[model samples]
Target: MTDFWDDEQELKKNLMNVSSTIESTVATAHGFIRPILLDHVQSVGKMLRPALILITSALGEQEVTEDAIRVGSILELIHLASLVHDDIIDSAAKRRGKSTVFAKVGAKQAVLAGDFLLAKALMLTSGKERGMDSRVVSRALSRLCESELEQDAGQGDFFISHHTYLRRIAGKTASLFALSCYAGVALQESEPTRQMLCHRIGYCMGMAFQIQDDILDYAGSSSKLGKHTGNDLKCGIPTLPLIYALKQERENGQTQLHDLLYQASTPLKEKTVKQALILVESLGGVQKAQILAESYKKRAFSDIKRLAHPQVERQLSTLFTKLSTRSV
Candidate 1:
């Protein structure tokens, strides 16, 4: 299957289309946080999750339904809204190479903007008071918020276990992704088998996607990621890669790295940070993480065979390959 970059132009075009649709939905100003929120929402991004939802929907039905579009759009809108809030917590200055709403309008304004987006999303999902998916989706959004709050509260706690980190990220990141794909399936079929397959596949894919994100945050640059590199590290969050390295360290490697990490939130010296990174890289942390991600992709794909065949299922299948090797 072709990778994401192999079809980079196609992906970009699809993203632009999704962005345009979302803007049309939420671009109006009720005098509160009008253009500021709109401009930030219009910033360039991959829009990969929504695209997956749509593709998975197509797998079940021959034609796209209005329900599918609305569901896909709402899923993405909620995800983006969460991002707006997350940037505030992380003190992120930029996203998609544009000044973040938090940077542009201050944290207070940014919070309002995020609230506005979320409120708008809720209204749309409510669908003129007869909203189709409001109940399930509202519950999902609440879960996502709780997950993020947990992660935020625990970010600085040195005692948080790896399992805690995994659960937190799964809720914060993978839950939305899972719902995106699950909603697609939900819209088309209520068959237990279909729903089960979609959930399992989406959950595993979400896990892999978040891990790759952790890997890139450390290994990639701002231009490629469209944000500050090592933001997580700087925030004193010992992510999987660093955590893995620390776990696998030789006696001295463990002591030195742990000491460097345990110190309260000072900017890790450049030389010291580089050594830690090198240690992580040497201990097979990056490789091990990739292996775990690949296992998720493999497990996700393994469930695909259980579903009835459709021609467009290929695109859904391609998503696994594309995500595994995507560059940006």
Candidate 2:
């Protein structure tokens, strides 16, 4: 199948615009903070969220406006802020194959930088240039913060339920995605129904994207992932695969893996993490997680089909396939 982005060359151009806009916007930070902000911009991700915003904004309009690029930049800044904060919380040394801000500048500096980026995002959103609803962004940010806290509190709790796990991801990852989709249509004078449909598509796609990311923790190559494999377990978070594996073990009256999973307070050795990963895989955790991820992908496709524009439908279908199958 042709790549989702293959025919959408305009989306690529729009993304370039988004990147340039982000550079200028972030450069406006305090002089002391400019270098750090520019450094973070260097690791700009695949621009997946911004691309979604640009595509949905141009659905039938056939134009990715300046407002769309501006909105996309705001979304990207918010995402970067979250990553900087997450690196500190996770104590991660590297992201996208480079030392994280926290690792280079220490936690205190990283936290202030993250806060600065978040504030800039809000400031851009409220600017007279676009006048977007700050309440929308604020609500998503609130959910993101709350979910991070919930995940932290639930760490090392092996019995974390499937419902709770899903809730956490919806807040942590999917909320921002939903906001991107909403912004896509909300910027234009589109029908309310179309806007709602786009929002649902983003939420479903985000859930699937994050689930696939979690699956990569066990199945992907660390070298290609640009981070250590099984780091999530080392951090004491019982993700979907581990949760399913433990359930399978219990049904079979197994206790060894359960004992290993409960070591939330103790620092996990690399060997222990490897052993736990092995047990989770041997117990069918990977397979179960794949099935769950597929379910979310199916939901996203269903929502995509509801979009009225044939071009939008085809593009979104290709995007869904790419996201579900990509190595990264």
Q: Report, for all candidates in order, the number of backbone clashes.
A: 0, 0
TM-score of each: 0.87, 0.93
RMSD, candidate 1, Å: 3.5
Error of 1 at 176 (Å): 1.0
Q: Tell me the whole-model lDDT of each prediction, alpha carbons only.
A: 0.70, 0.82
lDDT of 1 by residue, 68-135 (tens): 66666667788888989998887888786778888888889888888877776666664532212546
Model 1 bad stretches (over 4 Å): 1-17, 30-32, 61-64, 126-139, 250-253, 266-272
Model 2, C-alpha of 287: deviation from truth (Å): 0.9
Instruction: Tell me how far the alpha carbon of residue 70 in candidate 2 is from the true structure, in angstroms, after superposition.
Output: 0.8
Put down candidate 2 lDDT per residue, 70-181, tens digits, no spaces.
8888888889998998888788899978888898889999999999888877877646533246676778879999998898776667678888999999999999898888
